[model samples]
Target: MRPAPSDLEPVSRTAPADGTARAGRSLPRVAAALVLVLLLLVIARLPWAGDLGMHAATVQRLRHSLLDPGNPLVDADTPSPYYSPWTLVLGVLARLTGLSVFVVLRIGALVGLGLLVTGVLRYVRTLSSHRAAPALALLCLLLLWGPLLFAWSGFLGLNSLALTVSYPSVFALGLGFHFWAWLTRAVRGTAAWGTWVALGVLWALILLCHQFTGVVASLGAAAAVLAARPARAVLPRLGAALASGLLVLWLWPYYDFFALFSAGADLEAIHRPLYEHLAARFGLVLLGVVALACRARRDRRDPLVLFFVLGVLVFAAGGLTGHYSWGRALPAALIPAQLAAALETVSAGRRAVRAGWACVLGAALAVGAWTQAGTLGYVVPRDRLPAAVAAKYRTPWAGYQWITRAGVRYGDVVMARTFPARQIPAYGPYTVAPGYPDVFLPDADRRAAAVTRYFGGSAAQRRGIVREYGVRWVVGPESLAGPGLRKVTAGPGGQVLYRVVP
Candidate 1:
């Protein structure tokens, strides 16, 4: 049974009579709006970094061949997990509008950002009636991390969001917040069979878009259902929803969603970093941990507490078993704790307790903001930034557009080293080997070996690799001179572009 209104702490929903008090209440909203605007400008700049090329390559493939867009990074006909429903839609937009992949990503960033902001507002309303809960929750979500600035696709810290706003992960995460809100309402109130089915389909789409974020979303959904404590009648509806979701996953023709489970061995190494520096990277969220404990004490089935527990269990299992990829679920644990801290600040009954919580949260936010202050360099000129803020800024990678300018065309195979290979495919050229890991591609190992041999092997070995992959162009440093190779142009970082001789 739900608690009586009188038993719950009073939430401030109306502006105070005093003008100063009204203005003070509005400050958080204003601050949050300003931060969002800064993020929008950052999206416009679209700083090039990790996985940008991979996503760009996906869209580029879909644009040219919607039906059979093949492998995104390599010239193969294998299906790819990256070709999700979201990217297919993006591919259609890029084709119809004749826009660059980056331009399409910018549009996607706008939509994803809007979804995220409104989703937070909608979900927070279910937790607290306080007028400031949504704004405070947004702030806490973005700034409740420790001083070390960590940037990853599924993570939602300010710096991380800035870097990954254009990624499918952001769109998946935005949809996840909405998923939680919808599940909460559906479980709490009577809903038709159709509603449950729709919710199930939405859940599948989230998973298809970004698998890591999808895991986080699934955990949040489970927490919502468990906390609602539905009656026996709801079990059938839940089963129907599960069936619908599994059907969609099975029917997704682009890639085998279930097959991804077997591919975990290839991913553990890359995700190992997620397990490192936990205290330094996420220590500030301990405030939220305290708040979650408070909530759990009052109600054992509290959704946030359950969410945190589930996330910790999975993350701990990953570390113990060397399956570090499960660390992507860290946000699942962090998010509820952050929301709890924000909600407690506004709903605490005692004035002294509220004030103390606000002070600690405020100090934590200040430190976090400074830790992510380097984000300002995305909008402001780096040279114009203060020394302290500028010191934190890491320069984004300059792209491989230079090779394209020298006549590298779509579907043209370019022999490049690992770093250049990572970025070149973004401009529509195929690399000899994929820059990132590819679980589905059967010849991934062979392709990688071919690239290594072409760069460091004997002349006969280089010729054999070029012939085997049909390489038309090669990109490397100035020292990369050889017979049957003609210098085409130079790019950033003293790199030389070479074309194969007939």
Candidate 2:
């Protein structure tokens, strides 16, 4: 049976009266954090960068075809058979708002941002109940910057900013924070059944969002529970784990998610230097380490602190082993925990010293977030098409617009070398044969190469490529026209569409 609202208050181990007081006290910090998160999200206007467009397209497909027999996810004919609960939520939002999936993608980013801030605040509170630490640590998170080890690198702060587009990863990281914090309470015997239920729900959500993230969170949860007094902690942890497992089994293809563990094991090593991974929160890592050393004699065996420190090392190792996402999630899971610990260690300092540290931390986070936000100021627009045509495509903007309006159809395979795969779904419910790059899609590389060949290959090669991939229409420069292909429409600029000869 579900618990009553009154029952929920005790879950936090705070009496009703005390809980209200704490909530009142925390409200200002939460409000300020909310403003900061919203500001970063709004300023970034995080567009469809990277593979976000492909995910948007999936949501588009789901929105239109949920009841249709040709639903891409259920149909075995489609190239991608993967599942994404996040896209399902986006689909529902798109329907409710009557907005395009592209817009919903940005909204998802905003939601992820809010959750991330909430999780960070919860995490910081675990190490220190000092009222100011959440605000201070969060400010540093939003504004700090560290040295860039290379030209094409991102810091931890930048990674958070990029959360504007990485809905799954960001959402998972946010939930992982809450999961760890809840697990901390469960292990300490301060939590009620509701807390275990909350942890399980959060874990289930993370699993549905992304399997790799679920694995990382599961490790952290298991560590926290195991390190606690096992006799007392085992039942709650087991209950939470069972609830999570049952939820996963009920809502998702749990086995498929498990298979993802070894999916990219064979890929070439793309190892990042330790500095690039840690630079974003290098200051926190340094301060936390220094504080840990300074208090080694007294606090050396702190379970929560040790878990997070080991997390940094584990994720660093995972990155070295070619799991880049694991590496990126490290700072999200560990930094706040370490920062909270650092603050607790230094809480005995004079007021002036504490204020000075806070100021320095805030400035560094601001610089980092601002620097990262600058990179996204002019990212791809959220419109159905880019505002202007590129000279390289030699196509007028109207030409593509006409193609989108006249020739595109549901599930039609459109081929274009210069046009982005994202544009097809944005403008019409069509698929790009070799569309945007998605790590999950097996045929992404093969189809991407075929798109190149369709535009540049000889007549026979183009036909073979077209037949092989079931190319419905080719949209590109007129010069690339070949036999067995009749011009459907020679629109303005260099835009020309050819129907594949049956």
Candidate 3:
């Protein structure tokens, strides 16, 4: 089923590896993970958003089982899942050991992120199926870790932002979908891939544990389903994808709100004559269509191609419409499209093919090489930690692991945006907090006031709003813990208790 790699032909895969080199190759991946892991660990100290630090801390507590497991996500503020179960799991493991919960949380977030990057790399290699896939995979992983990480480093918005649309969580969802797809297949008396089922269960457990990932994962399963199967199986797989998607959407309350809220937006915004947007949105894809026209004559039914098509369609529609952050969603399709391009580059026999491959290859190499450098002079790579803080990470409970000869709750029922609060609630049975991305944590009236304060107004208006929100001590990640708010005793992340001045 694997394609062969081509230096000239447009369609090729790597030759099947024999045991020795295959086994030996593991070292490079290990080395890559180690490199990224260490860098991410160092980045953690440089002020990861206060919230990301908190999430790390929460992961620490969960690993220790310092709290009950069932509490939902944190902070209803700013529209996304704050909890990341995969990161939390690693934190839990660290808590079990003697490592600082802060270290554990930071390390775990980086490790999970690194592992997700590895998964993308392996997926790229497998999808490319080439000797060069390994090289390309590493390069792409490096791009993500290096430039992307650097660009998003301290800014820590949703995409690279800890709770904001973390793409790795989507990676988890893809893993979960693959699992459930196999489970369904097995139940149907078709070949069952227990491996997928195991993966699904593990991620589902993680999703249950944290909400941020759960949201992205929920939507990403449909895209991953195609990756797990070939054409003849597309119908069944699509159906499976649809069912899984529906299930995921139903479980979380946010989707409905997002959908509803988006619907409420000026219908004019949603209804922009489809043509104006689609043309701009799918300009690249239309070019791909030209490529497809050239390739279709040769007879192709490639999974990566399918991914490209679906991704293009979704990206175009999203950009054209007001659907959930289309740019972030674009990556699901981008991965496959990029891999297909990489594979085809080597596959084509033309001398020009090598030139084209060289460009892509060079870019990927740069991603790997400069992942840690923060350059305002340079745009940060996607995978590396960011050099600037667009917003400080906040989640109070994530910091300060309780050193209990025996465990005790401090009798504080603090509410937070999402992740750390989710983790913290479990720590103290008496503590109450938002279930997930809670609206209540940040006062609704205040958010309204904040909007008036920050939006569609003069600079003076924005400052007033910022000050007003800060004064209430109710807003999140932004104004909640600023200058007007005084810090009390701190946790590992400087998890501070800011009192609204009387």
| Top candidate when judged by lDDT against the true structure | 1
Q: State each model's C-alpha RMSD to the native.
A: 5.6, 10.6, 11.2
- Model 3 off-target regions past 4 Å? 1-47, 50-54, 57-99, 110-114, 141-190, 193-300, 359-372, 375-502
TM-score of 1: 0.96
| Ordered list by TM-score, greatest first | 1, 2, 3
Query: Which of 1 and 2 is ahead in TM-score?
Result: 1
Q: lDDT tens digits, residues 1-502, model 3?
A: 5555554343222332344346434544564565454445444542333244434434534554434432233222233333344554564566567775555554545544555555554555444455655544443433433233322221121223333222334335334334433433433344434443344455454354343334334344444444345445445534554455445544654223234333323223422333244333322323234344444455454544554566567656766665533433344443444444445545555747655755555554444345333421112233443534312223223232431212324333343444444345333321223432333244544544444444245655544654543332222333344444454434444344444343
TM-score to true structure, per model: 0.96, 0.72, 0.52
How many clashing residue pairs appear in each of the predictions shown?
0, 7, 66
lDDT of each: 0.92, 0.56, 0.41
lDDT of 2 by residue, 1-502 (tens): 9998888867666676576546644753674565465556543554334445446566776577543313231112333322466767777777777886657767777776677778877876776787766765565454443543122112235443553334576667677778787777777766666666666776777776765566667766765665565565458556876676666646563124544555554332343444354555354445455544544445654555555656767676766676655554455344535454436433736746654654554454454444443333333332433333221111112224466566667667667763445455545445434343334455656766777776767888887876675668777778866677778887766668777776
Name the best candidate (by TM-score).
1
Task: Name the runs in model 1 displaced over 4 angstroms.
Answer: 1-21
User: How much does candidate 3 score in TM-score?
Assistant: 0.52
Against the correct fold, how does model 2 do in TM-score? 0.72
